[model samples]
Target: MAAGLEARGRTATQVRLRRRFLRFVRVRPGERVLEVGCGTGVVVRDLVGLVGRRGEVVGVDASRLMLGKARTLCRESARRTRLTLRVADGARLPFAAGRFDAALAITVILHVIDPMLVVREMARVTRPGGRVGLQDQDFGVVAVTHPERELTDRILHGVAAHIYPEPHSGRRLPGLLRAAGLEGVRLQTDVFQDTTLEPWTKTFLERRGERAVRFGIVDAATARRWLDGFTHLVAQGAFVLTINYYGAVGTKSR
Candidate 1:
C-alpha cells in the first residue's frame, strides 16, 4: 500500500493535481496545515515544501503501520520544514480547535464510514476564515477503454460499490463542506489519465480484478480475461483510462 501511494504520488499528473489543490486552498508559506488520513505522507511531503521553513504540516492517520511508513518516507523532507505524524482518526482528530490555517483530506472521504463527521472535524480544527479542503475520485465518473465494455463496467462499478459506501464521493465534496458549516465553497475538477498502462494504473486494475473475483462480481476465468484485455490494449497502443478527481475548498465562518 505504501509503495502504491508513493508511486501514485510520483506520477506526473498526480503531482500537478495535488499542488493545484493546495494552491486552491491557499496554502502559503508560514501557515500551519493539517492533512487528515495522510497515508504514507505523500501529501504531507508536498505540504512541507509549500509551507516552507517557517510553516508546519501535521499529518494524522488511523493506521500506525501507515504512520511508520510515512515517518520513514518523510525523514529527508522533514529537514526543510516542520512535519509531524500522529496516529489519529479523521472523524476524531487529535488537535485543538482553530489550530490550523488549513485542513485537507485528499482522496480520503470515500473510504470513511461517516464522511460528514470527518469533514466537520476538519472544519473544527481549522481557524475561523481558514480553509477546509477535500479531494476524492468519483468512481461513477471513471472511464476505461476495453474490447469487453460490459465486463469492464461490471467489474469496475461492482468493485467500487462493494468497497466504498459512496462510489460517487467526489461530487459531494462541495456539499459536504457546506453542510459542515463552511462558507464560500469552491470546487476544482481534475482527471487522472493513463494511456500507456503505467505501473500505478496496472496495480489499480489488478486490485480491481482481484476484488471482482473475491466479491463474486466475476469468476476467476472471467477476471483473468478482463485483465488480459487491458494488456492487449496497452500492447496495441489503444489503452485509455481516466478518473475524475474533485477538489473543494471552503472557509470556516468567523
Candidate 2:
C-alpha cells in the first residue's frame, strides 16, 4: 500500500490530473494549502513546488508511519518550500477555522466512517474564497482483461464494496461537498487506461484474488483461473485496465 501510494502520483495520468486540479484551485504562490491523508506525500511534493518557499503546505495523516515515509519522500520539496507534516484524523483536524487557502482530501473519504465530518472540517478550515478539491476512485467501474466476465465483475465489485469503506465516494463527492456548504461545485473525471503494469494495477489481483471466496464473490479455483488469465494476457502484450477517477472542486462561500 505504501509503495503504491508513493508511486501512484508519479504516473502520467496522475500528473495530468494533478495539473488540472491545481488549475481548478487556482493555486497561488505563498498561499497555505492542506492535504489530508497525505500518505507518502506525492501530492505534497507537487503542491510544494507550486506554492514556493513563501507558501505553506501541511499534510496530515492518521498514521505516524505514513507521515514518516512522507517526510522522507518529500524531503527535497520540503526544503524548497514550507512543508509541515502532522499526524491527525480526517474527521478531526487539529487546526483553527479558515486556516487554509485550499484544502484537499484525495482518495481519502472512502476510508472514513464519517466522511461528512471530514468534508465539513475541510470546508471549515478553508477560508472564504478558498477552494476545496476532492478526488476519489470508484472501483465499481473498473474494467480489466479477464477470460471470465462473471468472475471479473465479482472481484471488482467485491473489492469496492468490501475493501473500501465508501466505494461510491467518487460519485458522492459533489453532494458531500455541497452539503458541507461549499458552493460552485463542479465535477470532472479522468480515466486511466494502462496497457502496462503500474501502481494502479499493481498487486490488484494478489490483494483481492484469493479473497474471491472470502468476499463470497466466486469459488476459489475459479478466482485462480481469472488471475492466471491476466498473467497469460500480460505475457501476450494484451493486458489492459481502465479505471475512472472523479474530481470535484468547490468554493467556500464568502
Candidate 3:
C-alpha cells in the first residue's frame, strides 16, 4: 500500500490534481493544516511545501504501518517544515477543537464507514472560517477503451459495489460538507487521463482485476482476459482511461 501511494503521488496527473486542490482550499504559508488519512504522507509532503517553513502540517492515519512509511518518506521535508504524523482515527482526531486553519481528506471518504462523522471531526479541529476540503474519484463515470464493455462493467461496477457503501462518493462531497454545517461550499472537478497505460495505471487496473476475482465478480480466467484486453489496446495505441475527481471545499461557521 505504501508503494502504491507513493507511485500514485509521483504520477504527474496526481501531483497536479492534488496541488490544484490544495490551492483551491487557499492553503497559505504559516498556517497550521491537518490531513486525515494521510497514507504514506503523500499529500502531507505537498502540504509541507505549501505551508512553508513557518507553518505546521499534521498527518493522522489509522494504520500504523502507513504512518511509519509516511515518516520515512517525509523525513527530509520535516527538517525544513514543521511536520507531525500520528496514528489516529478520522472520526476522533487527537487534536483539540479549532486547532488548524484547514483540514483535508483526499480519496479517503469513499473507504470510510461513516464519512459524515469524519467530516464533522475535521470541521471540529478547524478554526471557524477555515476550510475543509474533500476530494475523491467518482467511479460511476470512469471511462476506459476496451472491447469487452459488458465484462468491464461487471468487474468494475461489481467490485466497487462490494467494496464501498457509496461507490459514487465523489459527487456527494458538496452535500457532505453542507450536511456537516459547513458554509459556502464549492466544488472542483478534475480528470485523470491516461493514453499510454502508465505503470501506475496498470497497477490500478491489476488491483481492480484482483479484487474482482476475490469478490467473485469474475473468475480468475475471466479477470486475466479482462486485464489482457488493456495490454492489447495499449499495443495498438488505442488505450484510453479517464476518471473524474471531485474536490469540494467549505468554510466552518463562526
Candidate 4:
C-alpha cells in the first residue's frame, strides 16, 4: 500500500486501471486538464505527457502530505509539462468556473467526504463541452476463493465497504454524471483477476478482516484464520480473486 499509495507509482493492477481510465477520458493534446484528489500524481504524470508541452495539468489533493509526494515525483517533468501541484478540497476546488478543458477524479471519489459535491465541483470547473471523468472500484463486487463463501461475502460486502467509505462508488458513477447535468455519459469496467495472490489483491482480505475484528464484524480469531487460510490456499495452488472497477466519462453541456 505504501509503495503504490505514496510513491506516485502504479501497481500492476493500477497500470491496467489507468489504461481503462484514459480510454474513457480520451484527452487531447494542448488541452488544459484538472485532476482533483490526484493522490501521489501517477495519473498526473501521465496527463503531463498526454497534454504535451503546450498544455498544463493541475493535480490537487486535500492531503498536503500527498501533494508533497506528488510534487517530488512530478518535479522532473513539471517544468516541461507545466504541471501544477496544489492543496485543494474536491468539494470546493480553488479554480474559476470553466477554467479547464477536462477534469477528472480518478479513484478519488470513494474517499471524499461528499462524492456528490465533488462531482458537481468537477462539472462546474470544466468549460462548456469539456470532459468530466471518474474511476472507482465497486468493492461490492469482490470475490475471493475460499471454502467459507459466506464469510468471504461478509468480508467483502460488509467489512470492506465499512472500512472504506463509498466502496460501491463505481456503481453510482453513471447516475452521478447525469445528476450533475453532464451529457452522453459513458462507462467501462476493468476486472482484476489474479491467481498468484499478490499482496495488493490478496492481502486486502487480511487487512479487511483485521479491521472487521476491531469493528466486531468478525472475531480476532476468525480474522487470524482468514489470513492463515490465504497462505493455505496459495500453497495448494487454488487461490484466485477478482474485483471490478468502473471508469466513467461525460461531457459538460455547452
RMSD of each: 0.9, 1.8, 0.9, 1.8
Error of 2 at 83 (Å): 0.9
Off by over 4 Å in 1: none
**List of clashing residue pairs for candidate 2:** none
Which portions of model 2 miss their true places by more than 4 Å?
Answer: 213-220
- lDDT for each residue of candidate 3 in 68-97, tens digit (9 for 90 to 100): 999999999899798999999999998999
Q: Write the per-residue lDDT of candidate 1 for residues 99-172, one digit (tens) a residue.
A: 99999999899989899999999999999999999999999999999999999999999999999988899999
The residue-by-residue lDDT of candidate 2 on 134-204, one tens digit each, is 98887777888877877688787876788778887888889999999999999988787788767566576
Q: C-alpha displacement of 163 in model 1, angstroms?
A: 1.4
Give the lowest summed-lDDT range of ten residues in model 2.
197-206
What's the residue-level lDDT of 24 in candidate 3? 92
Clashing pairs in 3: none
